[model samples]
Target: MSSKMQRPVCLLIWLFLLEAQAFEIPINGNSEFAEYSDLVELAPDKLPFVQENGRHQRSLPEESGEETDTVDPVTLYSYKVQSTITSRVATTTIQSKLVNNSPLPQSVVFDVQIPKGAFISNFTMTVNGMTFTSSIKEKTVGRALYSQARAKGKTAGWVRSRTLDMENFNTEVNIPPGAKVQFELHYQEVKWRKLGSYEHKIHLQPGKLAKHLEVNVWIIEPQGMRFLHVPDTFEGHFQGVPVISKGQQKAHVSFKPTVAQQRKCPNCTETAVNGELVVMYDVNREEKAGELEVFNGYFVHFFAPENLDPIPKNILFVIDVSGSMWGIKMKQTVEAMKTILDDLRTDDQFSVVDFNHNVRTWRNDLVSATKTQIADAKRYIEKIQPSGGTNINEALLRAIFILNEASNMGLLNPDSVSLIILVSDGDPTVAAMGEMTAGLDNLSINHFFPYL
Candidate 1:
């Protein structure tokens, strides 16, 4: 309760921000790779996050390979991003070419942030007239190979860091002076429909200024695209206009900001292109049953109809008032509760269950979402304070009992939807209690999360 539950900082082998910091690969004067743990005890802010496009103006250590004052010694020549989306599945490839403009060997990192759930399929690096490809193998085989490489004095570093919805992959190499390194990374992911639209997001963070940075995307859907729109990124660097070429079944979207356009200001060297490029669109679904497709003996189907009347829902709000959620967290939750309660439909039946060390309820049973009931719920929420321990499983069981009892009394509509929203931030103090409902049969669970 004394400290905030902040997001854990992921380090290299671990590596975003709209927070670009040069994660210096801890390599000594020799070619051998030093343990990343040996890296200077630099805080996230203390790390070189060059406000000048991450190109520090300070003098480099005598052995850091480069000695330049005007530009970063590692100059990015070209960064090309291309992706082909077929039937909502996209495979994107990112390629970049960089040349060490220093007389001494320097450590350079090739970093990219991608969607969290996406899987990296392939990664390759070419430097000094040789190509190296990374492959996945059994742990034992990988360990044996690593042992052999270490014995032969070969060293390389590859690390990845993750946040809520994005992951950053960083590859570091020690390049000889004036040598060029080409990096290629391939990743794949499916753009699943969320809240009725499909979105494809691309993370763009060219740490330093780039001369040639281009992005090309092609979307092909047999069902045909209904709409395609791109919103302004990074405060309308392009004056709120995004050029998109769209057609019935296919579309093309390209973004090529010139070096001058990439700057934060007219003449400033700092970059203003460190954010997500998003594209949202919908596909045609002819029937309420949606579509069913069969490919190579595999089948996938979707059915979510919106033309019918909205089903009344039996909703239960299980909120946590644990000590971990004391100040700002509780205030935000209270604000969100006001909005959520306001969104409840008049026909919906809802109740509030607040728990910490003990379970408490505003009402013994569900109540219709009349104006008076909603106002009462808001008052109850404002009075709830954070203290004691978390008891998640107990709160959930209480919800089930209330809903079931309403059903038994014939107060619940047979066609009504059921939802139990649990807002908690700590682990339960009780043991596994999900199976406490062994008496109930024919139960199914469906999870719905909103992300754009």
Candidate 2:
């Protein structure tokens, strides 16, 4: 071989060897050694082998080798979920118990799925009477703590939320043989408005059935409650008909499944819930007041007051066009905006502000949602292309300014609803001056009203 080629080949081989050695080194020297020592101490008798050059050397087994026993994975012992819906806010609590039935110690991964738009406020896990709880913190601070915990082989927490309306909570817990662990998760969600009635749903598909499963729902409404409905598929699953209290102010719904009951179903899977349960309430339109209905242990409340004229609204939609919202996200955003614009009433007025690093308005002022105006707005939304960095503070301030100008010009009525809807997937990455928080506060105090 030529000397030039041989020289480069030798250098490449040396570099590869150096990279391999570097990767084998412990990230934290003391912690790694302690972890290895703890494992050796725990099972010195079971490990019939010796360490040679950092690798285990196992001895050959005898002719009559001892049989090895297998351990079952952790089983969900009990799952109990309860929800309370008042007005448009729903608070849900879930309690789950997991048991390690095998003789060997096990590390179990627990996952829970939450509906989109729900905010998880608290989570707690208890193992052998030792409790670990999680609380909300700034993103940067939370990331730092998570990194530290993972490096030290301690419990690290995270949440994965990618889709529009779904989030998954995943965590790991170690359980000793014959021991049990308990987890409690609490969250809040706002019910979205449908044609007439408001709706809320509880998802129960966790890929495994609990030995004991139960759900309790309570509905409270100061207004009177009307008719309540449950799916026919779950009719045989509930304890009894929903019990509605007199005056229709409260209701309750309960569901409990016995082991024998689930066994009787020929097509029922051992690890899966047979079907999802849905609850619906139809409010009495003639009541002209809010109504509450209770059945069994479930409750539903209708909060739309009657005998009042529909209020006109001035809505400003500030949309994000940053690089991250390039493909599917931008497509979905544009489609949703088109649907919303089409649904606006003739008396309602709206304006669109598409923003990236800079902001562009569809019009100088809010325009009535006439047929022609709606068509023009749809065309404008169709042409919006994703680009640049996120400037949430600037975009929001621009919206507030437009609304304030409208109010000053007497274009907005005192009785009308004025709202600014700011949509963005990323935080502020560009700021012209002051802090982003201060800029947001100024916008809020001026003309931004909070909406679900």
Model 1, 238-308: lDDT tens per residue? 66435588878878788877677777887777778788888899998876577777766666675568767
Overlapping backbone residue pairs in candidate 1 total 5
lDDT of 2 by residue, 256-368 (tens): 65544443354444533545556676544654455556655666655555456788888889888889888888888887788778889988988988888988899979999
lDDT of candidate 1 vs native?
A: 0.69
Candidate 2 Cα outliers beyond 4 Å, as residue runs: 1-72, 83-93, 113-170, 185-200, 218-224, 231-250, 257-276, 282-304, 432-452
TM-score versus the correct structure, for each prediction? 0.73, 0.59
The TM-score of predicted model 1 comes to: 0.73
lDDT of each: 0.69, 0.61
The most accurate candidate by lDDT is 1
Error of 2 at 258 (Å): 6.2
Whole-model lDDT, model 2: 0.61
Weakest ten-residue segment in model 1 by summed lDDT: 30-39
